[model samples]
Target: MIKSLDIVSDLGEGFGSYQIADDDSLLQIVSSANIACGFHAGDPRTMASTVQKCIANNVAIGAHPSFPDRVGFGRRGMDLSALEVETDMLYQIGALNGFAQAFGTKLQHVTPHGKLGNYVVEDSKYANAVAEAIAKFDDSLIIVTLPGELAEAAKKKGLRIAYTIFADRAYNTDGSLVSRNQPGAVLHDIDLITSRVLRMVNEGKVTSITGQDITVKGSSLLLHGDTAGSVQMATKIRDSLIANGIIIKSLNATK
Candidate 1:
């Protein structure tokens, strides 16, 4: 069972403008902020502001890089080559790092967002490409992926990996995320989610949608910062962990 999680708040493109929801969410919970960069979402202003906010809040800042499709909000998969992904990863991370530099800080990690990440998880070829991208950018920058797949790919390429498990979503036996279109994909029931998460932490496994036990090495548990009632869920998760004698800390510290 994994404990002492490094929780992240993914701020897709909701940074500068209409920041109320995000700002309020950040204030309550979140130890890390995965700020989007132009491709999937976010603009110059939003990126700058988001980095600043994370710095002010002492939250570890990261680049939430994604496919080049803002219209689809990076949820739609793109047919991009390895070179393209490599270049895009460099561009997004560099952009975020530049903005973080404005505040005399540096990005702590890189979490690939939405469709691109999904594609890589399903394709070993693409996973290799993604690993190449991260390795080129900075081998020290932790590659945040769905743990099993990309983590193995990144580790083989000599890059540090964070086994990122979603606190708001369910998993499948294949170790892929259950499609959002499915009935049990997203858990709105806080009690159910809490129980599931606690079970995973205390048991080192998540029962898949098909009832098979999937081995999970959860170094970081992600709480979707954009979901409705997300704040309440995060609060419950944090407090419940403490009450149960589980610690809330960084994955970096754990490793």
Candidate 2:
């Protein structure tokens, strides 16, 4: 039986006056806030404001770094060398850390965003670069990644880790997320999503797109804030998980 789970979502994904999701609502529901670090979607002002909100709500703050592609929202792939990836991660993490310090808090973890995040799961170069950067910056910071190469790299680098899983996205048979470009890759039905969350948390398993059962030993589950009806879905997931006797808490919560 699952005793607890940490629900996380991407926040601070806005620039100046343009906002992507209703962050205020999502922050109340999620235990962790993966704030954008100005590489993909946030500006300096946005980052500071978001950090303040996280502090206000007592939510754990995380740095969501990505390839420097604001126009593509960091969803597009880039051919960056290991050195480039390391520098990008360091720059973004440091920027957010500064804001966190100003707000009287500190970053609890680092989760790569979009394409950079996906590549870290399989590409050794990218995974090692990210792990090395985090280790060099602050070895105490948790490196959030899937249960694969990225996790291994972080372990080798002597960094703490938190395993992550997606609640609304379909996974391939190999435990990888289905491509967003594919049809039915992103789930919307509240009932379906809640059911999957229960299985993932309780049984430590999730059904893949090909109908294969895959092991998903995740301590944290991600609900994308940019998805339509995301806030409502997050609420439902949280309520149902609590009703089932699973404690909703942040991974960084005091043990």
Candidate closest to the true structure, highest lDDT: 2
The alpha-carbon lDDT assigned to residue 53 of candidate 1 equals: 76
Instruction: State each model's CA lDDT, in order.
Output: 0.78, 0.93
Q: Best-fitting candidate, measured by TM-score?
A: 2
> How far off is residue 180 in model 1, in Å?
1.7
Worst 10 residues of 2 by lDDT: 246-255
- C-alpha lDDT of candidate 1 relative to the true structure: 0.78
- Mind giving the per-residue lDDT tens digits that candidate 1 earns over 95-171? 88899888898778888888787877777767887788778877888888885557678878888777787788888
TM-score of 1: 0.92
Which parts of model 2 are misplaced by more than 4 Å? none
Instruction: List the candidates' TM-scores in order.
Output: 0.92, 0.98
